[model samples]
Target: MDLGLRDATVVVAGGGRGMGLAAARCFADEGARIAVFARTRTDLDKAVDDLHGRGSPDAVGIVVDVRDATQVERAFAELADRWGGLNVLVNAVGPDVRGTVESLTDDQWRTAFDDGVLGIVHTVRSALPLLRRADWARIVNFSASSTQRQTVSLAAYTAAKAAVTSISKNLSLQLAPDEILVNVVSPGSVASDSLLAWARSVGVDSEDPYALMAAITEHFGHPAHLPRVGLPEEVGPVVAFLGSRRNSYMTGANVNVDGGTDFT
Candidate 1:
């Protein structure tokens, strides 16, 4: 339960909101030194304060768009100067592009790849040196459950997430020699604020998270065995554990944090 994360240096690329912030909270509660990256300065400031309140000895929030390699590099440079090394890198950024393959435009596809795939690439590329300098290193990248399950109208999003999963697998193998464990966390529909807004936009006005998920399953066709959608808080501990020093041998694996899915 300790997770061996006290004083560990961690970078959460999308740690300003939703699931990313939730995962960062887990590390914060474990007393880690956390650096959170996100574009919105307000959200980053709020997250840093919250992390500090949650027990992080040191927490800094950086305003950086992961889609821009230069911004990402600069963010990591600052992290390097402050922490000297990184023990864990958690990439929680993902594009929200969703549509049928035919309905999605070329620009939308490019946006998906740029935000979901290249964003991760930028962070990982910039963080490698810092990770390598640490005594123990881990990378936990976010992927979507739709990638492993049969889902509808998520071609672009799924494609981008699939690339993230593949990249993590490859990184796991390549970094094995350095003892840097890499893994993926695939989450099903969670009742985040955006998801709640989406549900309301579609007239699925249900306050209950489980009932809301039922409506989503009935309308949107993404079903899980648990009947209810997972929560941001629910996914956080799994990510924290995977990125912790205790997770020594689990690498190149996609851990689905969905309520329950048949795929794996």
Candidate 2:
């Protein structure tokens, strides 16, 4: 279970909080050197501190919006200068807009695409060169289970993530010669700050976020097999595994970490 990640250079997008932070911590625990990217300086700093405190060989936070290609490129360059080369790139950044096609505005659609799809495109493009230089590389994208089982109000989000899955599959073929594995991890119902805030925004009572989430999940999220919601930590280890040298043959695969929530 070594994962062979010790001292590896890892870049985690949207690593400031939630599942991204969880993934960063998991990598750090395995002795990886981490460079976390997010837009907020405060959150980025705190995440880096937390990672270092958790036993990362080295940890740095770069403030960069993944939606901005220039910023992403520069951040990757900085990471390369600091860590020498990249071995893992986790696309944990995502947009939060949710609604059906009729309820969503054009701007919302564009924003969703920008945050979910284009953000991955920009980050992968920026990091491809460094990844190519590495003896082994992995790209783990955070897609969603909703892409497999369509949600009623998550039209735009699902569409965007579906695009991410498609892109990862295509890139897997292109990066095969380089031995760079590209794959998607579709998580369901992870209790993150973002998900809690989103629940509150959608009229869930702040005092009982879990109650609200449980009610919703019981009705919509537990159709597959496991009758429960997943946790950030539960999803993080899988991502770390996918990014590790241990994962030699798996690529272009959409692995569901959804507590069996999509089996309907």
Candidate 3:
């Protein structure tokens, strides 16, 4: 499918690596003008170069920490100036803040909320004007499946993602008049670099994400429907489609990309 994304301007938050990078590559493959935002200059540049090689030669990377509203605003300004306008804003940035509620401190809980919820808010607010300029605009935010399912040791993280889902639902109604759609993609057991790093840290040396998921399930007592875990590429195109012109009449919906796992 064309997805009608050719020449469309898109800014992906946390596109430096992992699932964000995967989504950016998918968009660029559909011929979108991509600009990736991240804190690390090296990762951002590398992702941009990879996107160009995939198809979007004009793909660029911007260094900006979404936690800092000022930096996000400036980065969006630069993106709008370069592209003339924006169509899709995908906030795929979220740090892993995992711990049992009783074990988590106030600062730890705050970090989870800040990364999962406030970061998306900052990006969406900063890009609203640019998105409004387009004939149709889309916002795709990330929420973990644990928000709906039970994932032990991730109480704070799940809580924060639940907030993201709520924000997307509300924004969908508020932005409907502008023809801007806001939706959430709740993923489970994605094989992202972040997830892999966590797995390795826990002494799981396997390359497969399902291995990580298995370890998680065994340790946390949460069962997955699928026998295996999903890869970044598995979730990337789904996000690209949601943020593309191809997706019409779907907003404020929390679409689960969790391999048919429904612990509810």
In TM-score terms, which candidate is top? 1
Residue lDDT tens for model 1, 97-188: 87888999999999999999999999999999999999999999999887987456789989999999999999999999999999999988
Please give the CA lDDT of all the candidate structures: 0.91, 0.87, 0.87
lDDT of 2: 0.87
> Regarding TM-score, does 1 or 2 come out ahead?
1
What digit string (tens of lDDT, one per residue) describes model 3 on residues 31-76?
A: 8999999999999889988998977999988889899999988998
What residue pairs are clashing in model 3? none
TM-score of each: 0.97, 0.93, 0.95
Q: Which segments of candidate 3 are over 4 A away from where they belong? A: none
- What digit string (tens of lDDT, one per residue) describes model 2 on residues 35-127? 999999999989988997887847988999999999998998887787677999999988898888999999999999999999999999999
Give the number of the best model, judged by lDDT: 1
Clashes of each: 0, 1, 0
